[model samples]
Target: MTHKIAVTSAFGVESVTKKELKNLGVRDPKAIDGSFVFDGTMRDVSRLNVFLRTGDRVHLVLKEFPARSFDELFDGVKSVPFSDYLPTDARIIVNGKSVKSTLYSLSDCQKIIKKAILSRLSEDKRTTYFPESGPTYEVLFSIRNDLVTLSLNTSGKGLHKRGYRDLVGDAPIKETLAAALVALSPIDAERPFVDPFCGSGTLLIEAATAAMHIAPGISRDFDFLHWNFFDKKLYEETIEEAKSGEKKQKLPFAGYDVDPSAIKLALRHAERAGIREYVHLQARDVKDLSHAKSHGCIVTNPPYGERLLTEREALELYKTFGDVCKRLDQWSINVITSAKGFERAFGKKADRNRKLFNANKECRFYQYDRL
Candidate 1:
């Protein structure tokens, strides 16, 4: 059955729209605040769980109502056929939020939902222990004024945990944001892509996965599989199908970092992700970066001193990094930084600049197209 599915995107990543949907095999997606609303069947949901790397969570927008009070909220919750989606004995928890409404208490909201679910089951609330066997249905209730939006959390643990980053240091880019960076970049992975300061190799990995159409969820487990409606057979089949559909390709992706330990960790992670054969990792300074001779891209988040270096040192690195871009004039460069006066440091005005949030600090996505 085709149902309304809500996809939660990273903040400042509203740019993920139908283009990404089509890329991820969805027909059309409607972009909303920090999310995209799309229609999909249960199988499609499973496919999304396997294929999508850029989204934070995918959920079924099961119900929405005008909930004014606890009674109305209870009715709204009870109106849905919960037993159809969740087993009577399924282990469950109610997650909720209220905004600008009388139902401001999260505890009260939980009670109301619990009562509604118990009433529907009628199988003795205590006996109906939450089942640990299948996918989980995460319920989200957003109350604003008299309207309430109830959604189920379909993608568990968020999409940023792309299963590849077994080791992450301070201020690593979230996988979702990394995907966005790659998506927003002019990088054509058919050529070559490089991240010079590839700390933990997030950018390099995201690029390779995006290029190869590798499903980000392949390495991780999701909470949705705990729900009664979850079909293990279908899930396994989807993974097998996606994997079988993968085409063997040469490595057009590489990363260089001066830190030997970082390179080692990145290589291990790539191997763990089963893509080490498709990615090349080397320990080198950014200043020594050489072109792969083909037209491609350089997308990287240089150290900003907050994690890897001091303020003076980060500024110095950016200064030299800017020089390198100028020298490698044929490459499209996408640089993300939180340092001040980046344009001046880079010695050119960015063709496009996007405001993005990285680990709570506001940053900019600066793009330069080499003519």
Candidate 2:
């Protein structure tokens, strides 16, 4: 059955909408605030679990309604044909969000719905166990102005957990965001891509993976694996297809850092992910990244003075960063930073700027296109 599935994306970031869905073979995708809505089957869910790289989570929104009180919430949940989805002993968890609604406490709202579901199941099906011992349904409640929107989390764990990076350095960029940045940036595998301050090799790995058409979830497992409706034959078919689809492509991407320990971790992670052959690792300073190429792209998340160094050292780093970009005049540059006066220190105006949150810190994506 074709169903309306809502994919949870990074809040306030629109770059991962249609492109991400397309990468996962999801057709006719619609972009929504902090989410993407699409139509697919249980088999497609298996593909998403293995291939999607930019979304935080993927949810299947069951229903939305106006509920002013606890009774209304109960009625709304019981309205759905839960007998078809939830087994007699299935566990249930409620994760919710509220904005300007009569439902003040999330716990209270969850308890009421649970009671209603238990009552309906026990009375109609004569099932005593409220939560059976199989899969789980994480229902989300979004209450706004006395209205409730309930949805089931298909992807139990966040998509960012690609299950490859066993080692991460200080101030590591999320794999999802790194992949999104690579997709939105001007970097192409035809030339070379460099991340001078690439901690944990996220940007480089994402670039190499994109170039080779390797499935992001190749070594990862997801929550949908434990769902009652999950089909093993269909899931295995998807995995085999993904494996067959991978092709050898040129990925001249490299990562460099001053910390040898960080470089060691990145190398180990790439080895574990089975993509070390496609990436080159080095321990070097940002100042050494001068004039690598004129037509490629230079992207990095440099030291932001958080746990690395002082404000003065960060400023000097930015100054040197400006020099590197200026020297490599033919390369388009895209940087993600939270440093104050970044553009000013770089001595160049960005062609485009996008505001996004990195680890809850407001940051910007500064882009410079060499025209």
**Best model per TM-score:** 2
Per-residue accuracy of model 2 over 1-371 as CA lDDT, tens digit each: 87678877775466564677786678877875567788888887777777887777777777789988788889998887666666777788887878899887988988887777677677778868664576777777778888787777777768777777876688998888888888878766688888899888888888888778888887776666776666788778988998898986657788999899989988987887778987789999888886455678877898887768777788789888898777788888888988877888888889998887788888888988862
Model 2 Cα shift for residue 346 (angstroms): 1.7
Error of 2 at 77 (Å): 0.8
Q: What is the lDDT of residue 104 in candidate 1?
A: 90
TM-score of each: 0.92, 0.93
Give the per-residue lDDT digits (tens) of candidate 1, residues 1-371: 77888887766776664466677677768876567887888787887877776777888887889987899999888888777777765556678777788889999898888788767665434364555454455678777776877788877688788777777755678888888899898766577788998878888888887777677788688777766577788788888988877765776889999989989988887787777898889999998887747477899998877777887888778778888776678888898988777777667888988998888888999998862
How big is the positional error of residue 347 in model 2, measured in Å on the Cα after superposition? 2.2
Cα error of candidate 2 at position 134, Å: 2.9
Error of 2 at 215 (Å): 1.7
Query: For all the candidates, what are their Cα RMSDs to the real structure?
Result: 2.4, 2.1
